[model samples]
Target: MDALPRAAPRPHLPAGALGLGALLVLAYGIVPLTGTSYLFEALLTPFLALALAGLGLNLLTGYAGLLSLGSAAFMAVGAYAAFNLSLRLPGLPLPASLLLAGFVAALAGLAAGLPALRLRGFYLAVSTLAVQFFVAWALNRIGWISDDSPSGVITAPRLVVAGLSFDDPRGRYLVSLTVVTLLTLVAWRLVSSPTGRNLVAIRDNETAARLVGVKVARTKLLAFAASSFVIGIAGALWAFAYLRTVEPAGFNLDRSFQILFIVIIGGLGTLRGAFLGAGFIVVLPLLLARLGAALLGDGFDSGTLEMVQRIVLGALIVALLIREPAGLAALLDRAGRRLGRRAA
Candidate 1:
């Protein structure tokens, strides 16, 4: 009998996965001990939520090649939906409310995605803009969604889950971190599945994908639904866990742009890019302000400094995009491969 080819041994864990796990452990376990309330509540929590949002968009645009600009609108849907569910049901649990909120967002995503069946590229993108505007307007005009608040705002309820209130800074950070971690894992798995392969095919060439028996419409809608589900949950976390306030303006076009930028700058198709881009988005402004203070001294005009910061940020983004069209994730990936090759 012919000798069977030797089977290659597989590593117990993928490269960087173990490092990521250890980093997460340190983040969840030791970082809280630092007792930096500002970093925890103001920075890390918000970054996590935004990273989740980026991951959601990345699923659609990165893997599926469906561009979206209304991520914030879906997020708003989730925030308001969860708020109303918890408020009206009274007995509804926080986890249930969050899940329901995601469902609501998914429904809305389907509604928005339906139009995508007929449209392509720029037209489809433009169509989603309508959803963004319409949702924002609805939140402002519709009294019931906002609980008829005089300010057109909804204050988030206490994030109580089975007698545990995540009201403290560390608690809130942990909650956000946990949710983001789970969702990230799920997304990783999703992108590795058969469905993910179909979506990528559809993205690379819709006609070829259709020829290969892929259901183009179905795959696209699923992408939208799945993306919106995660984004919606992130939105709920943004409201209940991070800001503790819900306002339509908070999830406006600017927020949409920010999320899109995170995806773009983080690396379109990679999951880790979301976090890297989000961290850049969150910390860059602070760093810019400090740089301004250090360079020009505290006596520098605040407005002028703000304008300078924006200019610098814009320039940096343009330069980075021009230098590495695939974003920072690709750069890191290439560097890692080079190091491995050298080590070998």
Candidate 2:
């Protein structure tokens, strides 16, 4: 038989890409089909939002070595900006409102980062605190943002897109998934690019980065802007998708600390760290509550359980920082290598 021309070899996807695709299938298809409605509304949706917030903080603090205590402030900016845009501009699309909200938050980050040029260490951290206080105050005091509601709590408008309504928990969860996936891809592209290298260099040693002709000031500003932009989108998701309402109290100092802990515990400078850390933070409480109930039964009061949870969480943070400063990502990586070696 005449040899037919060989067909072109099928292109294989990178393992990372294949793994990511499989994860997406699991999240979007399998989870929706098998997971409970309460899980979608209470756990997964909020986890995605918090994870995205951790990713944003990771960019600024992890990659760029900037210290911030007001991550929640930027979130507030995005949430309120998105809320206002969607409310006033009836013609604007929901995604457009979200993008614009991100821009607004970016501006706020730039303003907060201005003093970072001259400040360092504790001083810089304090400067970011100003942003946190200012945003909380504005969101609460500014009646305009809340549309003059007496309670300062406003319900998110219906999620209607292209004549489809995503008003239900499942639909909202899907939206959160889509947003996180897109932003994560963006973060990967950024860290893989020249800008990412600059961020790392600056983080390691600002003086050396500047000596190497890196625009130290510009890079810092860029880091802040990019970080805030992602965080802002997360805020929008938190408000519109997870919380389903805009409240000043939602993005508070405690919330900022939560996000910081997520980055710290998840593993600095690693993207997957955000997700891992968020899962830990979100699931740990439930686990502890269950454990307490199982062990102590009615003797373990809910209030006592909450207090114990916080104490255990603090102790774990200290232990992790001292023992595995690289975060859970490093630990997982080590385990994977060990398994591979054993298999070999």
Candidate 3:
């Protein structure tokens, strides 16, 4: 029998980017059709928001080589800014408020990042941590942001845009998908532009970048501003679409570290890594808990299972870093290239 004719390879974008885009389309387009509200709301929505936050951090830490530990603070600024704006001006649209919140966060990022411009490495990181503590304190101390709630918790404003209310799970998921998609596209372009090249230069060697007229200081601040803008939007989405509640405790130091871990575990300086890392962060523990319950049945306690999950997660992160420091995105790229060669 004659062998089947070899199929021609179709031209495409980078495999990682194309594959991720397709996966997102499937997630938003088809996942809800399965009628799994838990996956959509409890998992995917938060995953997208966190991924957006990771992407923002990747821009600053991964691409620009700026060390930051105040991502959650920027997020808090975004959330509280949106909360106050929406509260003060009830007539504002939700989408508009989110955008404005992002800008406000950008301003805050510029302020916090300016002083740290003279610092580098560990000092820069430590400087950013001050923003985290200050923002958290401000949120609790400022009654206007929380509306003086006795519990110090505030509910998110109603999510309404153009006569559409995203109160339901599917609606929220769609909103998140739309926002993330657009922002991802913008980030992709930004990273490929001249600005991104300067960031790379600054990251590699600040002196060299300055010698070559990169305007190192200005670029560093811009990186922070751009990163904060995106993170701020993510924060708003996390509160308005995912959690539907805001408290200073929710955006703590741990939250900042979680975003950092996502960037590290996903693959630094790459767009696809953000989503990959978020999937790992969001799905791994849930899988572990299910496995524990299946194995231990009724004998398993929630606290013990959670502890086990943390241990496993830490071990896996260590293993992955030791094995492939570039993270899962690099692994997938390698796999895709091999398959393409085989197909050829």
Candidate 4:
């Protein structure tokens, strides 16, 4: 008797950029077909918006050593700006409107960041609170911003692009996927360039960065602008794709806090952490509700479950800080290394 010859080893597929591109193609091409409305509406859309928000905040806080409590304020600026641009300019494309909206948001960010020159840490954070309050007040009191909507809540217009309407969940999801992917790539490129190094330099030591010929003031402002641009787009997506409305009250201090939490929980100065943290934040509440119903049966109540979810979330955040200060991305890297060792 003779042993059968083993089949030739399977060829390994491409990795790195090519592999990542393929994964993205798979996600964009297949996910919508297989996913439901709930998946798009309840999870992916919100996650993309929040993750993008986290990414923007990380650029300023994690890399540029600036603090902000006015993220949602910038978002409102983007949302309302886009709304107004598209509303007034009937011939303009939605994407163009959104782009202009981002610029508006960046300008607003620049204003909010002005106080950073004389402030840092908690003081900087407090100064940004002024931006938040002012933005909220303006949106509420200014009828022009809302187009004089009776309720002061401006519902998003048709999510149309290239004559295709992105009014449904599937369409909205695709829009978000495209926008988030492109922006994430841009962010990666920015962070990989010399500007990113300057940011890191500033983050490490302001005086040292200045001594080394880095224009600390200019760099900080540019960082704020770039971050605000991304966040502004995220804001547009939040209103147009997820919430489908631009209400000042809706994007309040809590929204800014949530974005901040996402950055902290995801990990500072890491792009992957943004998405990972957002996934956790968006999915946790739904998961908690499902688990509560499953375990507690019919006795569980919505209000009670909401409280439990918050408690659990707080506890988990504390545990994560204590156990892995670097956040979920660090945990993932550790796990991957362990698995690779076993595989080898």
Candidate 5:
């Protein structure tokens, strides 16, 4: 018998399957819940926003191998920029405000990255820290950025789309889901492009990349700018869809660390990791709190619950890292591989 060419292994679900699955799950969760379950929708908005931000940070820190501690600051910049554009600029559209906020944060990222040519590792980290502080300080210094509001909360103006106002939780949730979906698609495309490969190359070995004629400095700066821009948009969405408040304290160092942890726990260098990490970071705490409340009842103090939650979270993170350093995505990938092998 003529040698039969083995049929190409069936490809995994076509590109975007994972994204579509997530969207379906999100939609399913959002659509059926009664009023009493609105908290899920509320919580999901910020979770998705933070996930988008973490995706950006992963591009910088994981793919480009640039350690940045100023992601939250960029997010803050976008939030405040959106606030100012919406409230201060006469006749500015909300979309315009979001774009302007992203642009402003990108500029900030570029400026911060310029010094990266001279510094890296700990030095680069420290320099980004300066950006964090500088942005926070600037936010506090300028009253206009805060909208001069006594409460420092930037309530989103009613989202008017073609004369329809989206003020309800369902509307806001839909908006967040749409924005996050589009951005995640963009991120997926970007990471699959030549520039993404270049960024990865530089991350692996800057000297080697330069030896091969890669524009090392430019690539690094672009990575930084791109990452910050995405993070900025996420921040804008966060402010508009959920918090409706833009405050300096909200985008502090702890926020930055939390994002870092998400990337680490999710799967550094992979877009899937961002979603996984965000889910763990966001849902885990809430789940734990609910469990604690159920077990301990009303008499259980918040402080004890908080402490136990932290300890459990810390232990989980450590366990995950030790067991699968590549994060949850890697675990999933391995499972798929095993399944494929079994099928073959």
Candidate 6:
């Protein structure tokens, strides 16, 4: 067989820009080590976890052209899987439990992908929705999942590694950052590989990919499995680092939609978009809410604040789509080119 043509190289930030970014992150990590700021540490963990999940979802929807609405289900699977692993393998460490959880979620993702062989478009989206609901219902029905409790919540045990406890917010934040960074690097590598090219080909045109001997169905399934595995690990981290409790409600449709929105607003086909999008989703609301409260004072209620937030979010999405459908990354790229031209 002849070799496939190489894909165009991805546009990356300049080395100087990358160095600066790394320095900033290093500062963030080192500053907390001096003394913990519970608020900043607590906020950073969830932000990183959600961003990781968004990156996984972007791999499927943005790169592979597979629309998945059951991401939250995979997340739920990871959380429960971790819970069960912890209980069943009492001697196993937290890291091992997290890995097992990701594996379990990947299996679930593979099972969910089986239907994609025959489904597409709205049908495919609906089928994934079934996975979401079914997993949620199953979690509710099983007493073991709930630990025979009425509320059906699973609290993560304290993370003790090599005699060091990550119970403190600072320790947890560092762990989460490390996990996120490693997973993001892995995702970056995966997207630059041959398999990633196949996914993009499948996404751009399935019929053309088949003509080139790409196994369209198999590739799609692989994409889903890989995407879900990453998402599942992110969910486990979320449960352990942020929530410390897992419930079915935590992995609802809204969660899936939120991830989708992040990809759409950040940039559909890029990893950097995932981080930018997650930051927007997580940070913007809080900022807006605070601004709203300051303006509305005691007259504002929670319902009103929520309504305003939705309106603002919807408006921003529409504006971004209309002005720069390629998302924030595109805008940044254009700006960078302009600056370069001016300098030259």
Could you tell me the lDDT of residue 303 within candidate 4? 88
Q: Would you give me the overall lDDT of model 1?
A: 0.87
Q: List the residue pairs that clash in candidate 2.
A: none
TM-score of 5: 0.89
lDDT of each: 0.87, 0.89, 0.87, 0.87, 0.81, 0.84
* Top candidate by lDDT: 2
Q: Which digits, one per residue and each the tens of the lDDT, describe model 4 over residues 1-344?
A: 34333322211112357867887977698888899999999999999999998899889987787888888988888889988998899899988998999999999988888888888889999999999999999998889998998657988889999999999999999998889888888887777677888998999998999999998888889989999999999999999999986568888999898888898898888888888889999999999889989999988898898789889989999999898998888877778779999999
List clashing residue pairs in candidate 5. Answer: none
76-102, model 2: which lDDT tens digit per residue? 999989989998998888888988999
Model 1: per-residue Cα lDDT over 240-271, one tens digit each: 88998777899998888889999999888888
Under the 3 Å rule for N, CA and C atoms, how many clashes does model 1 have?
0
TM-score of each: 0.93, 0.94, 0.93, 0.93, 0.89, 0.92
Query: Can you write out model 3's per-residue Cα lDDT over 1-344, one digit (the tens) per residue?
Result: 44443222221124656766687778776787875789888798999999999999999998998989999999888888899899999999888898899999999999988965799989999999999999998888878778888545879977788998888898898888888888888888788778988998999999999999898888999999999999999998888889997788999999999999999999888888898999999999889888988999988899998889778989999999998898888877788789999999
Stretches of candidate 4 off by over 4 Å are: 1-15
lDDT for 145 in candidate 6 is 75
| Residue range 117-220, candidate 5, lDDT tens digits | 98989999999999999888877777777877664556667665556666677677767777777777787777777788799899899999999999998998
Q: Give the TM-score of candidate 1.
A: 0.93
How much lDDT does candidate 2 score? 0.89
